[model samples]
Target: MLDFTSIVMTIAPELWLALAGLVGVLLGAVFGDRFNSFSFKFGALSLFGAAALAAIHLSGGESFGGLVRTNTFVNFAKVISFVLAGVALFMSESFLKRHETIRYEYALLTIFASLGMGIILSAADLMTLYMGIETLSLSSYVMAAFHRDSARSSEAGLKYFVLGALASGMLLYGASLVYGFSGTTSFAGIAASDMSNGTLFGMVLMIVGMAFKISAAPMHVWTPDVYEGAPTSVVAFFASAPKMASTVMFANVLFVVFGAAYDQWQLIIAIIAGLSMIIGALGALVQTNIKRLLGYSSIANVGYGLVAVAAGQEAGAAALLTFITIYAVTSLGLFAGVLAMRRRGGMVESISELGGLARTKPVLAVMLSVLIFSIAGLPPFGGFFGKYEVLRAGLDAGLMPLAILVVIASVISLGYYLRLIKIMWFDEPTERFENTDAPVMGTVVLSAVVAGIVFMVFISELGTGGWATYAASGLLR
Candidate 1:
């Protein structure tokens, strides 16, 4: 049996988060509106605290009697989860206030979701992974519908739940198949299994299940609708950190658990990745809703991230890590830019609404232009570097055909991104493009813009150091 003390030490950061969440929920229940200001600040601080703990505890490994594992990859995933969770909290504060519900419970749910993500990242066994994912998914469904007054919000939550449940069922069945064949759910056990009867079927089922969760193609039908319907802040939450967790989990299952059967699954993953990219790029082209456009774009991004998994090599793993790190920051920047588009009226949701935005909000227009170019994989931008890493890894794996398809898909993606830029700069303004000022929101928007550019420019040189490398290394294990 593993030492109980060892498991506690290993998962201390998660423990802290759980406790903080519970405390916040209780305090919020008792204090009500009087607690709004305090709860918001405290929740943000607590998430920040979790991040600090994750950073400080990056050294220890192996916990929870072999059921839970800690390593560089999981640790890094934890760090990313905490960091993104912190950002979501900050963004949500303003969002909740605007919606007339700044309850501490909302922040607590997010914190709990972060805790769940950390659990999933560190889970060594399939059971633990399942629990973690469900915890996170359930909390997310609730957050999606938190603004229950809006029918769109309720519909988004319901759709996510139904689809998410189906995905979870597929994953669970796949896990059962593997367990029935190998008599164990541990990654080590799966890797060591000599039996081969259901391994391939199990792998395919498992990949399909994971693909659904990550919103990869063929199973990505629910993504755009849900994203468009959900609150913009919640959409941003779904876009960034969870993808990191799912990507890491996919690598762990495919590379660690099924390493012996790499040849069998690599081709399958490559095909999925390739199809995701093509579908994502093409589907996004016709989308007028900006969030829906981003939804399709995220599918394409996942496609690129999955290429590293398909490679099944250390360099590919490292590249995946770096790619996702850059991806999260850029996505956050993009979402923040979208949120900043509101003028004297409601949010500008349509792509055509951006016509001649450069004429008035020149600063925002410039930032949005940079973000769009970055997403399109233009040079000197983080998205460009991130995509490059994934492509390089695919080439190294000798998946030349798949790499070419990725390039073609990226080229197609340029249509929508460039279209947005053109409308922003060159097209005539609609009657809707009136003047307004939201100082705090504008500052937040500018911050994301500055962050995206800084990371993109420096990732090549500075990405090799500190938590980034440690973060990359964490994924390999």
Candidate 2:
């Protein structure tokens, strides 16, 4: 039995963020719009503090009757999520100010969402999982529509809400079935229970719902619109932190609750992986809007991560974490470049809008190109190394067919990724985009540098232990 003090110590980061969110709510109520800038700073600080606390308390154990878990695996996800979320909030202050009314509620909502994602990373029970996911979903729905003045933003939010609710219902029904068939809501209990047909059906439903959350294809209808309609800064956050948290959760539930049924579930995960890659790779080819293209690109990337997942075992889990971390940083860098594309006319969303960007804004163009190359899985970059690990995992697991699909998808993805680069470098110069301010420039450069160099350092420094590989090993052990 765990004492209250021990539980508190274990969940220090979550407690801190929870308190911070409530305080932000109070401040917003008291000062209203005046609190916007301050809220951004405060939210960023609070997230940073949560990251620190998570780092300090990092270790593995179950508490609250095994309803929550604490470990290097979960902590790794939480810390990265908090830090990336902090970066998003820190950068968004200026972007929000420039485009629309910077509401104090936005900051609080982000804080709340971070709090939810923190729960997601640590969730150990079915009820806990549902709560965390819904919290994150609700906040995301609101944030999608945050630019209330725009019909597209409102539409994005509404579509997200309706679809999100449907997904939630499926998840709930699955959870209920799992509980009814397995006789408990605890993941450990469910795993220990017999694999009845009803239980398997429940697991499938749950996996289907989770696929939607991660924007896997066939269930990824909401992604493109949300990416296109939401504010760029918010899209950046959506692409990075939430995806990281959800993917980690996906791996966690699989490894912990469903490991007993690996033989059965592996095929399901593999099928989803193939669909995501095919749809994402093909869908992006026709897209004219850069954000919509990225939306499909993200779906394809999720497929790549799922390939690692289908491979199973410690190596695959390690590859998944490493893949997602590199992917998140790469995405943040890419979107940072996008955020900088605001011109005198307005924000640039179309692919043609970037014509001759290299000639006009060489530094920004170079950074965006580097990120695109990195994501395209080209050589000597983080994305390549990340995919290398994933392919290695798939081959090690004898998933040759999936590996072949991965290669084919990589070839297909080059169509759009290279097209973006070509337009930036070779096309005729268009109207000059807005001069990128210091914060945005720093974000672009920092993300690009991380994509270009940081993962190399991580890979070189990694051997037998450290980071994604080690983190995954810790959980598996």
Candidate 3:
């Protein structure tokens, strides 16, 4: 017999977010133009409520016969996704309004995306994982092209949809192969089945599918184009929340279901990691567009997280979680700063446009510099510790060569990051960026910056706080 209470509790966060999305859509339909102001508040509140509910269930357990599970690890990732989504939505309103593209549907899609991420983080079976990925991808496709009038926006949507379809097909084919061989789609069932070559092939396909979602290399070709074409506010959410959920999902599949077959997948993941770091680092060096540069930077960051995943131990999982948390916070902060880069003409995308920003908008310049420094893995910033954690995990796992690659990637990444900083501080003034009166964007950026600084100062305490350890142990145990 099924436990009704357990099922309800287990799915409460997803239900709440789904309900919030429905309400947002209904508000848009009912009030028409009057819904814009309320939509931001509604979306933020809904995501916060869902995050709170997930946090309350942190001591999680299996429900729906283990199709879904809630535990500290799952809840932690979900809360981060929800909170980041909410912040993105809240910060996006002014930018969207200024672009004349504000709509309640934006909030609705964001809510739905958060719901999808929540589903992915809590999913305990292959079928459930597929459902979550589809939900997230479908919503993301629409969100990416929210500006229907712009050809670039349309291109982004079409590219994402086509690529996303290919990924989904691959995922489904791999799932079918696993089910055919094991006669089940559950993680436990697959784990207990014989590790045949076909089963291993299926797992590889699944990993490749997921790699596309996380923007890992070889599969990351779509990322720069999409990031460059999409609206910056939407890209902010894209760079942070979805990546978090996908990375956690990838970690879960590898560490939980495929634990016994680590030898088969480890080399593949290592290659992906090394390639992502190299491609992301080297590619970003020549990019003039800020968004494209950050997009490549994101690919590199994903590589760093994957290094931890390839460690295949509890420490690796913990380090992965920690690195992603830092990455999300810093990335959001960077994008928030990007959203603030406006002028009488329109929003700026070129790195040259930021030249001499220090003379006009000293505060924004400083914040951007801090974020860039952190991303470059500079000391006394959260990003440095984030890289250290992953490198430490890689070295501990005896993956010395991988650790060295990470260092090389970091050094290569510094070139572009410092260039951005130099443009802001040392170069001649190109144009005056208009001052943004967007309080929500300011608040989000400030919070992320402060958190990044604090996390750096308390790195040891935060990493050892048992959150990652507990979450990792639950999945790996």
lDDT of 3: 0.87
| RMSD list, candidates in order | 2.3, 1.3, 1.3
The TM-scores of all predictions, comma-separated, are 0.94, 0.98, 0.98
Preferred candidate (TM-score higher): 1 or 2: 2
lDDT of 2 by residue, 99-172 (tens): 76688888888898998899888888999899899989999999999999989999999999999999899989
Provide the clash count, candidate 3.
Answer: 1
| Model 1 agreement with the true structure over 395-455: per-residue lDDT tens digits | 8889898789889999999999999888899999885554433533553455446446776
lDDT of 3 by residue, 1-477 (tens): 877878878888998988888877777888998998789889988988988988887777788877987677778888888888888888888888888999888898898888889888888899899999999999999999999999999999999999989988998898888888878888888888898888888998999899999999999999999999999889999998898989988988888778889988989999999999999999999999999999999999999999999998666988988889889888888888888878888988999998888898887888788888887889988888889999999998889989999999999999999999899999999777787757645854674565457777777755645567766666743
Error of 1 at 40 (Å): 2.9
- Regions more than 4 Å wrong, model 3: 440-444
For candidate 2, report its TM-score. Answer: 0.98
Model 3 residue 129 CA deviation in Å: 0.6
Q: Given candidate 2, what's the lDDT at residue 111?
A: 90
Colliding residue pairs in candidate 3: 60-70
RMSD of model 1 against the true structure: 2.3
